[model samples]
Target: MVLPTLDKPVGQCLTNLRRPGGLGKDPERAQRRAEQLAAVDPDWNPGALGWTVDWQRHYTGLTLLLEGGAGLEEIVPGVTHRGDDIGRWLARQRRDWARLNTEQQHRLGEMGVKPVARPQKTATRTNTKTGATKGSDAFTRGVAALQQYIAREGTTVVSRSHVERLPDGTEHRTGVWAANQRARRDKLDAAQLSMLAALGLEWAA
Candidate 1:
C-alpha cells in the first residue's frame, strides 16, 4: 500500500473522502474501503488520529529510522529522509508537546519520544542612559508592534500608513513592515513564520 505525502494526489483524495458530503455519503462503502485501507496501514487517516498528514508522514519516517535501529540521540536536528526533516519534526513534536492530544502523546511515548526541556530565560540588560531595552532586531520589533496593534485594534489589518508606538517610545511602521515581511516571506525560517502566523498573519501561513 502506498502512503500519501502532503503534496500527493492520494493525500488530496483522502482529504476529500473525509469531507462531510463525500465518503460519508455512502456509509457502507466507506466503511468497507476504510477497513481495506486499515488492513494495510492502520494509520491511513491521520486526521482521524488528531493530526495532519504532513505530521504523520514525518513521524512515519522517524518510526522507519527507529525500526532500522537508529538511536533517539541520533535523531537530532538536520537529519533528513525523503525530503522531510525528521529531526526538525521530532524537535517540534517535543517542543510543542503540550499542544498534542492525549492519544498523540501516547503514540509518541510508545516511540520513546518525550517533551524537550525549555531553556531558562536570561534577563536582558536595559540601556539605563536611554531608558530603553536593547538588542531587539527589526523583525522582532515589527512582531512586537504587530502584537500591540492587534491587542488595541482586535485585528491584523493595518493601514498602509499605520504607525505603532512601543512602550519604550520607539515607533514602528507596522503596515509597511508587515507588507515587507510578506513580500520576503520565503526568506523567513519556519519558527519565524510560525510566530507571524500565530500573530494572525495569514500570508505567513
Candidate 2:
C-alpha cells in the first residue's frame, strides 16, 4: 500500500511496524503484502532508464501493476499518465527499465516479511534481602516467613469510619482499620531480637 507522507521522513514509518494502523497490525493485509513481495521476480531488467523522480514514480507504479498481474507487454505507457512525458517514459520502461535505489528495494522486502530471529527474555525472581537473582523457592519462603511473623504479632485497630450517602438518603458506613506491625517487633525482648538478628531479619525494629 502506498502510505501518504507524514510529518516525518518515510523511513521513520518502519519504526511503528506493529503499532495500530501500521502494515503489520492487520494480519490479513500483512500476509497478502508478504505474498506480493515474495512474488517479485529478481530477473527483471532495468535498461537505460536513469534515476529521475518521475521515472521512479512510474517505475514503482509499474512494479505494483506487475505484482497485480500485468505482463511486460500489457503495461502500456499512456495509461499511467495524463501527459505524454510519462507515457513515453513508460513505453521505454518495457525493456529499458531503471534500477531502483536501495531504499525502494528495502521497502519492497519489508512487505509481509517474517520477524527476524532474536534472543528471548528469561523470567527471573529477585531476592529482596540479598538484591540478587535467585530461585522462586527462596523468594516464596521469605514471603511466607514474613507473613507468618506479621500475623503472629501485628496489632490492628479500627482507625476510622467511611460513610457515604445513598440515593435513598440513607448513610452507609464502613470501618477502616490500621495495623501496627512495627510495635510488635518493638515489644520483642533482647533474646528474641538476637534470635531474629541471627535469622538475618529486621523483626526487632
Candidate 3:
C-alpha cells in the first residue's frame, strides 16, 4: 500500500489516529492501520517522538543531506531540499538549543549539531561632532524602523506604502525599505540577513 503524503488532510488524519476515539471509531481497523504506518516509518507519530511533525520533517531533511555526503559546513543558510530551507532550520536549531528538550538535544547532538555562540549586542553611540547617532547607515536605520514597527504592530507584515515614524523625529518608509532590501538580498552580508530574520522576515530566513 502506498503511504499517504503528509499534507494538511493527512496530517490531521494522523493526529486523529492518536486520539482516544481512534480512526472511524473502529479500534481493530485503527490498530491495523497504525501498525501498517509504523511498518513504513516508525516515527510516523510525531507526538511519540516528543516533537512536532514540522520539526521532524526538517530533522529528516538534515539527516538526508548528511547521508548524501553533505558536511555540516555545507549546511549553512540557503541550502534547500524538498522545498524546505534545511540550512536555516539547522541554524535555528543550533541558535535556540536551550529551548529544546533533552531528547531533542540528544538527537541533534548525535547528528553533530551544536549550539552557536550568541551574538554580542553593540551599544548605540552618538557622534560627538554631529550630535547624531553613529552607525545609522541605511540598512541600520531600516532595521531600526522595522524593529519599531514590529514592536508596535506585533507583526512584520508592513504595507508597501506604510511609513514608520521613529521617536527621534526621523521617519522611515519601512515597507519600501524592506522591499528594497529583499530585492538586493544577494548583496547583504550574513549579519544583515540575520538582522532581517530576527525581525521575522521569511525571505531572509
Local distance difference test values of all predictions, in order:
0.74, 0.38, 0.76
lDDT of 1 by residue, 1-205 (tens): 3444555577566666554554566779888888887897888776566555556677889999999999988998798888777886787778767656798799889999999887897765655523433323666788878876764444567887999899999788998988888888998887678667555466774
User: Which tens-of-lDDT digit does each residue in 80-143 have in candidate 2?
Assistant: 5333233334434322112234544454345321223435767655445345334333333332
Residue range 1-205, candidate 3, lDDT tens digits: 2235654576556656655555457778878888898998888776555555556778899999999999999998799889888998888878767656698899989988899988786755545534433433777889878876664444567888999998899789999998888999998887678767655577887
Error of 1 at 118 (Å): 2.5
Model 3 alpha-carbon miss at residue 183, Å: 24
| TM-score (all chains, Cα) for each model | 0.55, 0.22, 0.50
- Clash pairs, model 1 backbone: none
lDDT of 2 at 175: 21
